[model samples]
Target: MPGRSHSGGVIRRLAPLALMPAGAFAVHQLRYWLAFAGRTGLLLQQQGHAYLHSVVPWIVLLAAIAVGVFLQALGRAFGGQCSLPRQTVSFGALWLICAASLVAIYIAQEFLEGLFVTGHPAGLAGIFGYGGWWSIPAAAAVGLVLAVSFHGAHRVLHAVADRRARPAVRVRGPARARAPRHVPAPALAPLADGWSGRGPPR
Candidate 1:
C-alpha cells in the first residue's frame, strides 16, 4: 500500500540518525551492567544499597540518550551538505559542545542524586570538588566517540540514499531457439542421371 511504502521510506531516512544514540546507550548500559556484576565501586550507595535502585539513574541515562539523539539529528541536518573539511570542523565543534553538555549533565545528576537519594541538595562546591575534574576528560572522550559515531552513521545514510536513488535495471529472459528452414535439397539434382522406371534402357 501507498501508506505502508511511505512509512517505510520515512523510517529508512530516519533510522540512521538514531544509530549513534542507540550505540551510546548500549555502551552505557553495558558498562553499568558490568560494574554491577563485578561488584565494582562505581555504583554509588545511598542508605544501605546502591543508588541505582532509585529511579534517578535510569531517568538521567534516558535524558542523556535523548540529548545524544538531538545532537545526532542536528549533525544530520547540517553535516551532509557541507564539504569534508567543514564537516570535520563542525563535528569537532559538536564534540566540544557534547563535552560541555556532559559536564553539565554530570553536575545535574550529582545534584539530583543528593536530593532524591540522600535527602539533601548537593552544593556546587561539593559537586565540583577535586575529583570532579575527571569528568571533563571523560566527557571529552565520550564526545569524541559520539562524534565519530555520528560520522559513521552519516556515511551509512548517504550510501542508503544513493542506493535508493539509483535507477533500477530490467532483466530480460533468454531468447528462444528457432527451427531451421526447409529447402527440399534441390530435388536431389534430378536423380543425377534421370533414371527412368523402364529398367535403364534394357
Candidate 2:
C-alpha cells in the first residue's frame, strides 16, 4: 500500500455535481422571492403555486443548460475559444428564448389557473407587457445566471469524467527494460567417438 492511493468513494466525488444545481435553484427562487415579495405576495400564496413551482423552473434550467452548451459550441467554432461577439450573440439569443418562454409559460399558467383555480395571478398578466417591464429582463437575468451555473456544472461533470477515465498510477519515467534471465544451457548426452553421419565408428 506504500505507493498507492485511490479516489475510491464514488458518491463523495460526485457530490459537487448534485449540490450545484440544488444550490442554484435555491438561489434562483430566493432571488425571485426577495425581488417580488412586495407585489406578488398574494400570487405566491395561491394553491396552484405548486403546479407553477414544480414545472416551470425546471424548464428554465433546461433552457439554461441548452443555451450554455450552444454558447460553448459557438466558442469552439471560433478559434477554439469564445470570441466576444459570438458570446454576445449567444447571450442575446438566450435572452430572447428565455424571456419569450417565461412570458408564454406565465400566460399558459394563468389560463390554466383561470380554468381550474379560483382567482388567478392577474398581476402576472402584465409580465413583460405594459406595467411589468421588468418581467422579460428579470427572466433573462435568471437565464444568464443559470446559464453560467449549468456551464460550470457541465465543466465539473466533464472533469470528473476525465478523472475517472485517467489511469490511477502515473509513471514519470520510461518503463525499465526487463533484464534477460540467465537460463542455464540445456543438458545434452555425450557424443561417442567418430560418430559421423557419413562413416561409422572405426
Q: How many pairs collide in each candidate, listed in order?
A: 0, 0
Model 1: per-residue Cα lDDT at residue 46: 23
Model 2 misplacement above 4 A: 1-39, 42-99, 121-130, 168-202
**Model 1: how far is 185 from its true place, Å?**
27
lDDT tens digits by residue: candidate 2, 46-67: 5344554675676567556545
Error of 1 at 109 (Å): 1.0
* lDDT against true structure, model 1: 0.52
**Candidate 1: worst-modelled 10 consecutive residues by lDDT:** 79-88
Ten contiguous residues minimizing lDDT sum, candidate 2: 79-88
For candidate 2, the lDDT comes to 0.47
* Alpha-carbon lDDT, every model: 0.52, 0.47
Clashing pairs in 1: none
1-202: candidate 1 lDDT, tens digit per residue = 9999567446544543443433333333343344355543444332222644464466566556555654554454444431112234477787777667666766676566556655333666434542445556666777677677656655655554455556679988998898988867555554575764455655
RMSD of each: 9.7, 15.5
RMSD in Å for candidate 2, one decimal?
15.5
